[model samples]
Target: MRIQKRTAVAVAVALIGSLTLIGAGTVTATAEETSVALPSASFRDIVVDGVHDRVFVSDPTGGSIVVTDYAGTVVQQITAEEGAAGLALSADSSTLYVALSTAGAIAEIDTATLTETHRYPTGSDTSPQNLAMAGGKLWFGYTVGSSGGIGSLDVASADPAATLVPSGRYWYYAPALASSPADPDVLVAGEEGVSPATLAVYDTATGGLQKRAERLFTSSPSISFLNDFAVTADGQNIVVAANNPYDHQIVRLSDLSSNGSYSSWQFPNAVAVATDGTVATGAVGDFVKTYRPGSTWPSLHEYGVNDLQRDGLAWAPDENRLFAITGFSYGSAPTLHVLPDAGKLDTTLDVQAPATSRKGKDLTVTGRLSAAEPFPAGTTVEVTRTDAEHPAGTPVGTFPVSTATGEFTFTERPRGTGDITYTATYKGDGLHTAATSQTTVTITK
Candidate 1:
């Protein structure tokens, strides 16, 4: 397999296709602002299998998928039979399932062997797009061979002794797949002209209807022709993608385990949740809404990715990677980008502070932490300066992130000028916290 090092622009040198990074000049926005610099790497499709310790990405145009370590080196590559589009890695990250949309077949690849060992016949016109793994079975999207509409395939559970679960159910056009929130139910996200595109769940043990959202397909005029989803952890949520009029959404899974009943919990956009436990979504023209579990309405935040637009997003189990799949709409293979380390995401820092000083004056740099989540008081928040450097006179003191509201302050009088940066060592309880960048203050002279 051809492995290429990253170039500034996705050049036309060959294996995949030309991945040009036509850089644009810097543009700016506010709190809903252009704060963090966009991340580097990109792939056609990106999936991080924490169980396997590597990321799996599909190369539809290239006809192969490249696997890489957390450090971003190509570790393995799987070339599909013909037109490889959909990719599904098992929960354990050992087996991989690839869909041959044109060939109307699904090939199961042994990740360890990096080889295709099992193949199933889906009929012609069966355009398999994305495949999902659940309850040790494989479910993929398809178009009916005859009438031609969406459908799915289910592989039977194999006997424990056999590694290959060879005998199982293979379906089409009946009950299509619906997306779910971190649950074990098989989920599919779109339907033909149906409102809200019904999200259904079947019992893994019975392969029968356990629960579903009957008219979720009818969010008329708001959402349409939806398909495919990236589920949140616990499968309690999923971000829906629809085209033929493209728009996106992050909706909640109807919790049905309790009564095998139907319900819609009004969740939205899986990508927003990828940022933190918070779910953020809506059209660019609409408000960029944000919310966690207990909040009333989602708080609004807005910004643009000058060179990038995200159609899908994922959060790792370790919660350190806020990753996105880019280049889907522009006809380029998806680029896998890792933005702001998860450890750095500090919700504890989302509270309001007392104040700041005059540009040239030596003011105490300080703020109050929200509470004790992952980063409590005493957590080290590292400070660095850009532009001209913290105007020479500011005394750099390490302040404590208060345990109560986490009120923290550092005595750093101005030396000169700078784009002040704070790298917080957040031991906070939030999902995205690894080492987050606090607001960058520019000191003026």
Candidate 2:
């Protein structure tokens, strides 16, 4: 076992080679994107367990689950039942659940041992396609013969208990499922393989599916050929990706009302939300975008990938890494792409002052600290004065910026003449990058 594991690791690293960041837009100087070629011919789902520092990729075609370290180094490939497809991790991440579509059961694996410990059967001929754990149950979207629907397995129950929700029988194909820890009682499902796909939000607080809100996209801001979707960490909004929208749609989970959308390249296909409220979206084309919560614009770190698979993105809980599966072309072999510092949103700070001013006069200094997300209330920007006397740049003042606008203004008196420069600096917060901008003012007698 030791020798085989060592060889597998070596082969995985060799296949990874060295990847260079290409076709990036506003990526931070320190951000690096890496890729590792997988041994599988196809991919169905990707899940990251920050607790274990492991990434699990399910391959129905290979009937296996490929495991890798945080750096994309192959750790082990656990053989699963036939048709290993959708994957979900337990809330604690100690256990991983895999949906075996052909076997009509869910395989439970101990994450630490990388071994299949149990197989819970859904039913004969019931092919589960997607899995979501919420409300203390393992909910799944499955197909029974010609019709498809959703079901759940009671993980806490002593017996292998499964319930096929009767309300889910109306779908043409199996839907994709998503849930959030922030809202533990909510489960979201979207229909597959159909235009104007039906999306529904369910309340699982009662231990059974109760329809909360449903939408069929036939009106304005229409969606078609639903590819993937996700619920925000706070469970307040659902992000949708469809073939016709040309961008990811965001809506209130309460009423299914349009909240906003994240604009992306053609063919928006995948969307994932980090625990820290960072949103990562993918497209079939070259670009993938990450946005801070409630921001319509892609964060400054939006970068490009070759071609992302449908439902191919996942984020580490700490936001340190983003895992994406990509192929050079449709129906080709896929590779796992790991982006380092995936949560760092770049910021912009600009200082404005009078172009010309007289010595001993007060000047209005104005600036804005721009980021993917708004700064909180009471956030301040530090200003420094640089003139003939203070070339080292003396601290002038720190003023609060508008929480809504990120704009700030202050008054400064220049004692020295000649060209004076005012520098505005936003030191950055946990998820944002520091930024500095300066504007010079000529001071005369």
* Model 2 bad stretches (over 4 Å): 1-28, 328-332, 347-429, 433-445
Candidate lDDT scores, in order, read: 0.45, 0.80
- Tens-digit lDDT string for candidate 1 (1-445): 1111222221212111112211111111111111221122233345667665666666656677666655555676666556676666666667777777667777777777677888877665566655665544566656555332333456554521112121123333323343433566655434433344544444443443333543344433245444344455456655554442344444555542211111113222224344234443433223233334333232322323222333344446554444444444455544544443422322433211123335656554444333213344346544443334444423243556655544455655556554555433334444323333344555666
- Residue ranges of candidate 1 with Cα displaced over 4 Å: 1-45, 71-73, 123-127, 146-182, 192-201, 208-211, 216-222, 227-252, 255-303, 306-311, 328-334, 342-400, 407-445
Alpha-carbon deviation at 43 in model 1, angstroms = 7.7
* Model 2: ten consecutive residues of lowest lDDT: 18-27
TM-scores, all candidates, are 0.57, 0.74
True-structure lDDT of candidate 1: 0.45
Judged by whole-model lDDT over C-alpha atoms, candidate 2 comes out at 0.80
What lDDT score goes with residue 27 in model 2?
A: 13
